[model samples]
Each structure stands twice: as structure tokens, then as C-alpha cells.
Target: MLITFIISSALLTLITLAPLLPSNHWTVRVWEFPRLQIVFLILINILLMALLIAQDLGPFLALVIVNLCLLCYQINWIFPYTPFANTTVKMSKSSDLSSRIKVINVNVLMSNRDAHKLIALVEQHQPHLLVTLESNQWWQDALEPLHDAYPYRVNYPLDNLYGMHLFSRIPLSDITTAERVEQGVPSIHCIANLHNGKQIQCHFLHPAPPSPTENEESTERDIELLGLAREIANKQGSDSLPVLVSGDLNDVAWSPTTQAFLRISGLQDPRIGRGAYNTFHAQYAFARWPLDHIFHSEHFELVSLSRLSEIGSDHFPLLTEIHLK
Candidate 1:
């Protein structure tokens, strides 16, 4: 029992410090996703060590101190997302419908055939904008009915899982499909003309993730994200246009890359004080993280943010409502 406790503690400690290294290798970056899970394991480790307290006070005390420090470190990064923490984006009290924009972002697994489930959500929410990732030609055909409701559209359907589609009820202008890093993977940029005569710059992205099969390193993903951040920062400096960036970033909210993107883009995360709003791996309750995200400039205030029901995909849809302030 003591040996098992020691091994678990050692492994947990290693995982806690692995991401601290300055490496973009998939092995290192993948460790960043399971911080919450690690926290849970740490608690269990502490409890097990407490049960073996009679064995040796010295080693037990050492392990407890190290685990406590790691716990604090992990909590510090995720603290802002907890309900106890103050919200980064202010709540909106406005009742004006024209100034409000409700968006639904989903990563429909390329192979998943239950398109009707997502169609149901669009019908139920009646969102101003809908963004889908991993959408192929078949998925596009499946969602053809949405054309009437979402007249302004930018479709870039591909067999590759990085395919994206942006459908909007609001008038979209200056729409462009950009490949920031890789040639095939594309990102969407457009201007959404709100009913209140306000225009917001919207960016939709579905960057490749660092994984054994997808990307051995996070270089391309980081380059794409940071490049967009720099452009948004430059544009925001001259004109404070309300900017909305949403999609499957393929990076967790607490990751260093995502944090850098937030800092550079000057966009606010609505999930910061509300909840994790985990959207990926919908089939697995224990193995889920917030891979999908909706970030907007400070010019918008939060109306509501929620994780919608499963749609037969690995990722659940993320529904967000923000008021253009």
C-alpha cells in the first residue's frame, strides 16, 4: 500500500511540472489539457497518504507539502474560471434585441452522421450566428436547410477534419477564407452588420491540435493563433471595432498558448468566471475539456454562456450571447 502511494504521488508530481518546460512537442502540450483531472488525482493521493500516516511521518509530510504546493499552482491558473472568481467580462442589462448577438459554435465530428441533432439546436436557439468545424461536403448538404435562416454564409467544406463553416443571419461583408499557417486548414474572417447599425469583426477558427496523429508539434497551431492575435491587436489599436473570435481553438482555456492569444488579442473570455464549459469529448464525462471557445473584445458584455446538449459528436455545442456595448 505504501509503495502504491509513493508511485502515484511521483507520477502526479511529474505531470504537475511537465508543462512548465519550454517545449511545444505534443507530449508536453498534451499535459496542459488535464489540469482539472490532475487536481482531482492530487486530492485522492492526499487522502491515501493520510491513511498511511502511521507508516512514516517524515516522508508523508514531505509528500503532503509537495502535493499542496502543486494544488495551489494548478488552482491559480483555473481560479478565474470558477464561480467564486469575479467575472472578466461585465454582465449586460440591456434589453435591446438589435444590440444582442447569440452565437452557437460546434465541432461536428467529420464522421458523425446525426446532423439532425445539431439542426434541432439551431431551431431551438435561433442564434444570430452558427459556426461548425470538422464539417465535410456531406455535413454541408445535411445543413443545407439552414440556408433560409442563415442567409449570409461562408462554406469551406473539406474531407480534412479542419474544415469550417460559418452561417450568419446578420449581413456579412469583407468575408475571407484565410490560411494563416497551413495551406489546407482555413480560418474565416468577416464583418457582421448588426441590426442596430453596429458592425462587429468576427473571426472563426478551427486550428489543428498537437497530438500523435494530428500534429507532432504545436508550431502551426501556435503560429496561426498568434498571427491572428497580432492582426487583431493592430486593428484594435486604430479602431475599437467590436471583435468576436469563436471556434474549436483545439487548445484548452488555461494553456499558455491560449493565454498569450488572449493577452495579445485583448479579447475577453466569458467562461473566465462562469465555468469551464467543457465542450470536447462529449461522450466521456471524465475525459472532457473546453476545446471550443468564444472570445470577444471588451466592447461586448456577456448576456449568457452555456454548453448545449450532445449532438452525436465528440464536442458539444457552445452557445454564447453577448451584447455589443
Candidate 2:
């Protein structure tokens, strides 16, 4: 019994930590560490109680190490989401409409070569802005017809997995990429000018997954995103500015790390109460979670959000429209 408990507890801890390893699928991977931790703690407590009932101090003392591990796990789990509340009580603000913006973010696999489907999605949604990840020159050339409609463009096509491109019908300004952490990986950050002359900062990101073929760990990608969120949150009146951080975040909405990012950045998820609109590996519908996300500051209200039909890519495009206050 002692050996069984020791082995099972150790195995659970190892499985919980396994996601720390790199993998392209790490973004959507669900590591139920919290539940595992709870299970172990409950088991340990029950064991101690049983031993105490039998008046056998040996087994109780023997399980001391496992108890300590559970304590540590609980400590980490207790970390707060974010310092800011969901909505500020001091500022009872109404939603914005003049600053409305619609965006489409898609990770069109480089090998997809099905630009026609992408074009159809664009024509159907008519998003104010469109950002594509894993897009190469082939994708850039395929999407040429869109340039005529969406005059503003930012193309940083790379053969590397991090290729990114952006097209917007609205005027965009202050366009720049975070070159430091986003080496070969390309991201588009800019300010969009609405019809009402409202300017909102938009960021499109597609970080490398933590796969053996890609990054060794998701820490760098996760940290970079969290850092950006913190920067946005620190900005005074950031909520009023109507900032949007969207893309193939490669992380699920339920992940603790992803939730922390949302809290620290003062961003609100549009998918609250919405079903998990999984986007990746569309072929395997059952194995899907909401990998792509659109997180925005408080000033906007979600008008529409959905996943488009498959377009010969592992990922399905996500479209979100928000009325900006």
C-alpha cells in the first residue's frame, strides 16, 4: 500500500509537469494539474485519517513527503488571476459603438494552398481587418485579390513557421513588430482608424508552439504574450483606448496561464458563456478546444464571434466583431 501510494502520487506529479515540455500542440493541451493535486491531497488526508484511526504512526509519518508536495502544489495553485476586478465599480461606463471593428484571424497552414476558401471567408465576413499566420509568399500571392479591397497591408512572409501577414480596409498607423522576442516569428501591431476617426491599437500574434520541432518550451511565448498584456494594462485609460489582442494564441482559454494573462492585462474574453469554439485540427473535431482567441479591453461589447468552415488547413479561421465604446 505504501509503495502504491508513493508511485501513484509521483506519477501524477510527473504528468502534471509534462506540459512544461515543448510541442506544437502545447497551446491547446489541457493539463488537469489542479484536479490531480486535489485528488492527491484528498487521498493523503484520507490515508492519514485511516492511519490515525488504527493508531499506527508509521504509515502516517511515511506519507509526510507526499503531504509536503501537495502543500507546494496548493501554494502554486493559489496564485491570483489578476489584481483588477472584472469591471470597475468606480467607473460605470456604457459600451462603445462608434469605435466598432470586425477582425478575422486565421492560421492558414503554409501547405494549405487553398487561397480560394480563404478568399471566400473574407468576402463573406468582410472584416475590417484580416490577419493570417503560417502564411508564406505563396499565401501572400494567393491573397493578392484581397489587396484591391483591403488597401492597407503589412506583409512579413517567412518560410519559417512564424510567417504572418495583415490586411485592413481601415487606415492603420504606428505599425511595428516586437522584434526582440519575435525573431523569425512575425507579428503585426498597429493602430486602426475607424470611420468615426476613433483609433484603437490592434495586435496580431502567432507564437511558435512548444513542440519538439518548434520551441523547446512554451514559457518564452507565454511570457512574451503576458508581458504585452501587462504593458497594455499599465497604460492609463487603456480600457478606453479599445485595445484588442488576437490571434492563434496557441493556448486554451481554460489554462491557468492564459487566465492569468487575461487578468494581468485587464482584458475580457468574448467567449464567456459561449461554447468552446475549437479551431485547430478541424479534421479531429472531438479533440478540439478554443485555441484561437480575441481578448479586448473593457470598452468593447462582443457583437459576433464564430469559427469558419475548414479550408484545407489544420486550423479554422476565427472571426470576431466588437462595438467599441
Candidate 3:
């Protein structure tokens, strides 16, 4: 029991400290996703160690102190996502439907064949914009019926898992599909004309994640995000256009990269002070994080934010409504 406790504590400590390193390698970056899980394990370790403290007083006390500090550190990063923290985006006070933008963002697992579930969700929600990631040619065909309701569309279907599609009830113009960092991975950018005749810039991204099976490093993902942030900052500086960025960012909302993206772009995350709203790993509640995100500029305020029911994919869909302020 003593040996097992020590090993678990040591491993938890290492994982807690891993993300603080500056390396963008997959081995290191992957550890950033499970801070909540680590906190849970650390608490268990502390309890177990407390029971066995008599056997090894000095070492057990030292481990407890270290774990306590680590617990505080992990909580600091996640606290803002809890309801205790003040909301970064203010709540909407407007009742005008024309000033509101409703969005549904989903990452349909590339090989999952349950298209009807997602289609049903779109019909139920009837969002102004629907963004789908990892959608290939088959998924595109399955979603064809939506064209009647969502007349404005941006489709770039590919066999690659990074394919993205955008369907809009609102008019979309200046649509561009660009390969920001990687050649095959595509992201969609466009201007959405709201019912009130206001134009808001919308960007949909599905950057490659850092993993052994995918890109070995997070450089490309970071570059794509930070690059887009710079562009949005510059554009807003010039025209002060309202902007909304949504998709499977492949990074957790609490990660350093995402924090930097929010700061640089001056965008507001509705998740902050609301809830984590973990979207990925729909099959396993224990192994989930908020990977799908919807961020907006100061021009918008949150009307509603929710993690919708599962649609037979690795990720749950996110439905967000923001009122133009």
C-alpha cells in the first residue's frame, strides 16, 4: 500500500508540473487536458497517505504538502470556468431576435455513421449558424436536406479528418476556405449578415492536435490560432467589426495557448464563470474536456450557452446564443 501510494503521488505531481514547461511536444502538451482528473487523484492520494502516515511520517507529510500546493495550482486555472468566477461576457438584456446570433458547433467523429442524430439536433435548435468539424463527403451528403433551411453554406468536404462545413440561415458572404498552417487542414472564414442587417465576422477552425497519431508538435496549431488572433485584432482595430470564432480548437479552454488567443484577440469566452461545458469524449464522462469553443468580441453578450445532447460522436454539440450589444 505504501509503495502504491508513493508511486501514484509521484506520477500525479509530475503531471501537474508538466504543462508549466515551455515545450510544445505532444508528450507535454497532452498533459494539459487532465488538470481536473489530476486534482481528483491527488485528493485520493492525500487521503490514502493520511491513513498510512504513521508508517512513514516524514515522507508522507512532505508528499501531502507538495500535493496541496499542486492542488491549488490546478484549481487556479479551472476556477474561472466555474460559476464562482465572474462572467467575462455579460448577460444579454435585449429581447430582439434580430440582434441575436444562435450557433451550434459540433465535431462529428469522422467514421461515425449516425448522421440522423445531428440532423435532428439542427432541426430542433434551428440555429442561425451550424459549424461541423471532421465532416467528410458522406457527412456532407447526409446533411444535404439542411440546405433548404440553411441556404447560405460553405462546404469543404475532404477524406481528411480536418474537413469543415458551415451552414447558415443568415446570409454569408466573403467566404474563404484557407489552409492556415497545414496543407490539408482547412478553416472557414466569412461575414454573416444578421437579421438586423449587421455584419459579423465568423471563423471556423479545426486545427490539428498534438498527438502521436497527428502532428507531433503543437507549433502548427499554435501558429494557426495566434495568426488568426492577430488578423482579428488588426481587422477590429480598423473597422471594429463584430467577430465570432467557433469550432473544435483541439485545445482545452484553460490551456495557455487558448488563454493567449483570448488575450491577443480581445475575445470573450462564455464558458468563463458559466461552466466547463466539457464537450469531447461524449461516451465517457470521466475523460472529457471543453475542446469545442465559441468566442466572440465585445460586441456580443451571452443569451444562452448549453452543451446539447450527444449526437453519436466523440464530441457533444455546443449551442450558444449571443446578443449583439
lDDT of 2 by residue, 165-250 (tens): 99999999999976547578767889999989888888888876665677756766777788788888788472457788998887
For candidate 1, lDDT tens digit of each residue in 1-325? Answer: 6577678878988888889888989998898998889988898888777776857767578778878888899888888878998889999999988999999999999999999999999999999999999998999999999999999999999998988998999999999998878878999999999988999999999889999999899999999999999999998765668999999999999999999999999988999878999998899999988999999998989899999999999999999999987
Please list the residue runs of candidate 1 whose C-alpha ends up more than 4 Å from where it truly belongs after superposition: 54-56
Q: Which has the better TM-score: candidate 1, or candidate 3? A: 1
- What TM-score does each of the candidates earn? 0.97, 0.74, 0.97
Q: What C-alpha lDDT, on a 0 to 100 scale, does residue 11 get in candidate 3?
A: 89
lDDT of 2 at 79: 30
Put down candidate 3 lDDT per residue, 1-325, tens digits, no spaces: 6577668878888898898788999999998898778878888888878876767677567678887898899999989999999988889888898999999999999899999999999999899999999999999999998999999989899898988999999898899999978999999999999877899999999999999999999999999999999988887765678999999999999999999999999998999998999998899988988999999999899999999999889999999999998
Each prediction's whole-model lDDT (CA): 0.91, 0.74, 0.91
* Ten contiguous residues with the weakest lDDT in model 1: 51-60
Candidate 2 wrongly placed segments (more than 4 Å): 1-98, 238-240
